[model samples]
Target: MVIVCCSILIISCIAVVSSGMKVSLEVDRPWLRVHLSQRAALECCYRTGAASLRTTWFVHNQPANGTAVPVPVRASDQVSSGYRMRGGVTCGTLTFAEVKVADSGLYRCWFNDAGVFTPGTYLQVYEPLKKTINLSEKTKDNILMAEGFLLLLCVLVPSATLLCKSKQLHALEQKKATREEENIYQGLDLNDCDKAMSLYQDLVANEQEEIQLENP
Candidate 1:
């Protein structure tokens, strides 16, 4: 007799629950990260079972607890925000447009059939700070880049100039050595030695002038 009574109670409870049973509200994009001063979309989805679905927007979990209201689902393609106007969930989706820093919080999507309740999902909005510098920062970056290139060029140009001079000096040395070998039978000549010394002095003076210009 007790078992029969318990069975009846169980059947009554199941009937009450299944009568209001609805599809699960699974929010596709829950955790959304956004940068400061940039626009983002908080997307949501509700799983509509065999029966057609109804959707309402909410914030901070509970619906009635705050100012969050239901966007009437409309039948047309005209999207009021991202969801249709008539609470008519198409493919069970919704979009929170132009999301801001203050919008950084939890959002809710409730699934319903007529006026009855089902289930929902929570969306976490994250606002990450981003720095977009003004004219001053741009100017500083440019100046730094220019100075670095200028220094590199200055160093490289002088090294190249010195390398060229050394090569020329080596050539001159070879020529003088050849002449000395030839003149071994003829005797000593002071003119060639004087010309080489003059060239050396000119190179030294030019290099010193360049160094002074660069440093200043």
Candidate 2:
């Protein structure tokens, strides 16, 4: 009869422990963005009525249908993984020595105590801070591009102007040379007076011969 009475008491205690209880989950930060090779701490705080609890950490991905995959947290020379328990509360800290690109995802903390499980706190981990060109960098790039264009214009415009001026100068020199050659030819003709008189005598002789042939 004593054994039966003890079993009944145990059953009643189990029933009371398994009853609905209020619990809440809290995180230190709502979102986090970290760089590669940097350490990240995902702090989780759970408030529950249970005196003792067992907590599990998981990484959930949407492609996996929000399934909670358990993360192996062991105290190692590289990474330290552990949890702390206080009066009616627990905090689990997962630390990484060096973060990688594959480590970016959503994390959650699950707890179970006395058959009651509380919803977890989600911790987001990022792979690394992306190298982004901010407004100033973009503006600097634009300025550099504009400067390059202006420099090219400065070089090309002067080269084009010099080329045009050289063409114009060459034309003027050619015209001047032609005019000087014509003046030299005129001076030579004016100096050859004997040759002009001989040509006029030959023309008069041919005209007299034509006139005598016509009269005969």
* Every model's TM-score: 0.36, 0.42
Kindly list the per-residue Cα lDDT of model 2 for residues 173-212, writing each as its tens digit.
9999999999987777554788898899999999999999
Off by over 4 Å in 1: 1-27, 30-55, 60-97, 112-168, 171-216
Q: List runs of model 2 lying over 4 Å from the truth.
A: 1-22, 27-30, 49-52, 61-75, 83-90, 114-156, 162-216
Q: Which candidate leads the pack in TM-score?
A: 2
Local accuracy of candidate 1 as per-residue lDDT tens digits, 1-216: 345434533553454357676443332443566555445454454444455455555554325566555334333332233443235444445444444455544444444443322232334445565688556888999999999999999999999999999999999999999999998957756788789999999999999999999994
lDDT of 1 at 37: 47
RMSD of 1: 21.0
Give the lDDT of residue 211 in candidate 2: 96
What is residue 196's positional error in candidate 2, in angstroms?
Answer: 37
